[model samples]
Target: MTTFAPPAGPVTGALPLPVRRRPGFSLEGPFYTSAEIFAEDIDRVFSSQWIFAGTEAEIPRTGDYLTVTFGHQSVIVIRDGDDVRAMHNVCRHRGTRLLDETCGTVGNIVCGYHKWTYRTNGELMFAPAQPPNFDKTCFALRSVHVRSLDGLIFICLAADPPADIDTVAGLVSPYLAPHGLKNAKVAARSEIVEHGNWKLVMENNRECYHCDNHPELICTFFPTYGYEPDEIPPNLLPAYDRFLAAENDLHAKCDAAGLPYEAIEELDGRDVGFRIQRESLDGAGESFSADGSAVCRRSLGGFTDKRLGRLSMHVQPNFWSHVLSDHAVVFSVLPLTVSTTVVRTTWLVDAEAEEGIDYDLDELTTVWNHTNEQDGEIVARAQLGVSSPAYEPGPYAPSEYQVEKFCSWYIDAMNAGEPRPEPAGRSTGESG
Candidate 1:
């Protein structure tokens, strides 16, 4: 029989969360710098939540798969005919890792350490020299709970993943289905390792307070994001006026197209916090380019107008995406260490769109590529500041409400004995 370490002890054998998070301020420095806290984070939060894996677009074929690794866990997300499945990367026999490449198409999963093989659905297919007495049925690859919401794949390592996802899918699918992300194809993919704690990276994405540093993104994305209309600052009032006008036009267009444009923000007080909306871009009101124009000539979701604005969605702990008339961009964040995080960015366009004829690869990808680089530098500096002994939690501004909400959700998950997920059905606020 195989055995594991730390039978019933804490996985990290670490003390309980070292400090209480102050309301409306950044987390204490140790939360971002301590290995113990990082380990606790993995065992409690990441291991127990519904984490967004890559989109189905990355694995369009029946046998395609992608591997996701964070901390000590690795999962293989594969497409098996009509459904997507998630399983531990470890082989059932001798616990050998079954697949090593980041992603690829595989007829079956075969371990390199030993030749034990499993079918695409993770059923043990062969055990090189096992006796007839050995029960292959007992050794199927351990399965992880997985859900694909309109093509965006998410997996939970926990035995009972948050049931809120069913409700979340129901709420967000109308906003996402029009983009047809499940049937789309990947245009470009990029991965970056940021020099910061995973929380810091998430905080940076929750608000636009520092968007002034993202020149390329700010041109199309409103810098006034997250601010209440009445709280708009004097310096940003002109931009706010432009946003209002664009929103009016966007609403009419959406109505005519039978699309939903209202916002549904549920970023806290639940296990599966999230937000979704279809809002207008600043300039051409199309895509994430300098002029907000459509980068791909071939329209997505059968839309010929090329001006459907942006359908943005954010799911707690680590996932966000924006789907436009021309394409969709998805991001997944995973913790690497106490002071490091890795982010994967994917761009999806119509499967029929030609690289050179219907889209210019550089133009389609330049905005987000540069924006991610700039954010990486910003997160690195934030990490450096948090590591210093003089660091202290600071207050959040009114415009940074979502950052506070994100922190609230993070703390609740970290401190949970059994997370209270939002029930299977929610009508208002998407509440628990």
Candidate 2:
């Protein structure tokens, strides 16, 4: 077995290295190309950390279930009457996979290979043609730790969690509450497979540094492009606090008004100066808007006593929350290999809201889909460039604080010698 090397730093228990004081702009190259580094990251980061699973809305009815993956492990998220459960999808008898479909309802789970069966609640039910000495009670589907925030589901592979759900919630609650995510429902889903380290995709998502190169998509939303490190907006500086105060204030107002709130939309074209002229590579007329108000109104809606159209927030690591007037959107980045990743996105709305009648979901989906495609194209190319012998790590611009902060945190996690905080309600036995 390959032993993991912690990042460079003084001994601080078993954690990785400490982030350098100077602008640490680049990750070690091995992170992008080494299978050993990938394995270490899976052990240290993905396994111990809280990962966003599918939302509660995906399995709203009893016996409903959805299959997901963490690292290479297949898992199932199921509604067992009153509680939602997450279990390893592998069968105990000879270890054949229990579920092959992505999702479905089965009164009882039956392993096709040996006909081993389990109840929807994860209890071992029976085994056909078993050895006389085989014990059914001794084997059961392994369970993972799970928690729900608003209606979104999170799972942890670690057996012993370092923190409670409320603490984790506190870290992101400010942003989540404003968008009303706790009661949100799923509307649409999409996925993108990219050829690059997962971190590459995350690095791109955390910064608007490439806005200048995106002629059609993001440039339309943010025309003033700046690749220099020094150009960060003052309000967005100190990345962690960027939307905390604003979100808290919004939540307070909602509470005072007795309104069911989830999240706020952060896509007001006005904030980013939508009226500014931008050049397009397609030779389409120079893009210009009279004001951001039109775009915001169309996407979010008018702010009134009863409605506050949209709000957007990002939790450190790799989750993005786009809170629209009547719904919410979430995006997650999952690493498949050192150079491959699976990107998943979901649109959420009120469980009671009727699709097409309550909102035109296609309108909202189109904007995000186009935006993601644009992002994917750019990052894929960047990945190819990074692999080039001529490529070198660059310095950070003052204005690109968001991207810088993300890098800083990633380095800290990679170098920390100690284990990361665990997800809620998990113990070591529960982790694989």
Candidate 3:
């Protein structure tokens, strides 16, 4: 196995990142092609903010854990007693890396280099040949700030994470709670390494302007996602009409069930940017299937209504999800390099629901599986284009407003965070 490691410092580039950008336009090539900017993104954007890690249902039992990796850092998110906790996945002794596997249950975190052991709660349990002066408390694994909004897990590596996470969570949890993700089980998961900058992957997801590229997705998915009522194109007018009718029905059902269906979009100008709404799917208005019918037979959260539509949410930097009555699909993005990214998509369903009986494995996963592949190709082409010297930033249509917001949020994040210092007086300039 290749032991993963990050670069010592930012790789130098010819052009520095611009502080300001014109509204409704794509970022300049350097933002996508520069390794220096990518390093800054890893530090100022990923490290200092509350990132969507995983779901609580992932580690439902004590000792269960998941590992999240991004750039230089690896974090272990584990269930400790009744609480979920996160810690740096590094052995306190000798700085040996711990928990190499992507995920597995462990009675205790043990360092292979030494016999240093830690409890599931991260307390140092045992260490051979320790000096009398060595305090076990001091040797405990360094903890990361962790919080869960109902079931979605988030972690912050910073000493003080954004305080707005609580505010965002409070506003989002009620809409997410009814899906019962905390009680759900991961039905399926798909991970892909896309040849694109992390920003491109997120920017692609922020709007449906390019959704026409996803044929399988556009079947039930309303391509009118980011379009304003007046700004909607003539070609998509029929879809807009259908969307309006379905939204009315969805709102009525939500009201009857006492669920929140209104849109809450605060995608920018916040420490923890996000957007959420319970919107109607086309056709049967149930799920992402070709006919808009649920792939899972079992309903989530004991919802008697299978046509509850989809509760979709997007968090800045690296996460988005859609919760339907039948199942919930969650996605998280992580950068591997300046021009490569990893996208993980997980499907969750009722804990008691059995596979093959309550849901067909293929049907549960097919729509998004195809959509993700299609998106990967698009991002790869985009990466290639942006890397070319002839490439120039392009204008974004009005329907691409969310994409503009995402870029705005990214710029704000990069500007607001303190710059990371270069290590050992290393120059962050072009070094052949």
lDDT score for residue 90 of model 2 = 91
Q: Please write out the lDDT profile of model 1 over residues 106-191, one tens digit for every residue.
A: 99899887788999899998988888899988999999999999999999999888889999999998988888888899999999
For residues 1-432, what per-residue lDDT tens digits would candidate 3 score against the true structure? Answer: 111111233322222444346667788888888888888888888998888899988899998998998888889999988999999999998888889876779999988998799998889989999888888988899999999998999999988888999899999988998788899998988789999999999999887888878888888899888888999889999999999999999999899989998899999999899999999999998888989998888888999898888999999979999999999999999998999998999999999999989999889899999989999999999999999999877999898888989988887777666466566559666667
Pairs with steric clashes in candidate 1: none
Superposed Cα deviation of residue 5, candidate 2 (Å):
4.2
Q: Name the runs in model 3 displaced over 4 angstroms.
A: 1-20, 425-432
Q: Is candidate 1 or candidate 2 better by TM-score?
A: 1
Q: What's the TM-score of every candidate structure?
A: 0.93, 0.72, 0.93
lDDT of 2 by residue, 1-432 (tens): 112344435323343332233354655456666775666566565665566677777787877887776456777888988788988889987888888766678888889987888988888889887789987888889998878766667776778643544554554455445445545566788878878888788778766667655443442243333323255456435432423443455467667754444532221111110011111111111111222111222222222432332344554445665554455567877788878887888877666666666656665466567777887887788778777777666776554555666655555444542344344665454655
What lDDT score belongs to each candidate, Candidate 1 first?
0.88, 0.59, 0.87
Off by over 4 Å in 2: 1-22, 171-183, 212-309, 416-432
* Count of steric clashes across candidates, in order: 0, 40, 0
Q: lDDT for model 2, please.
A: 0.59
Best by lDDT: 1
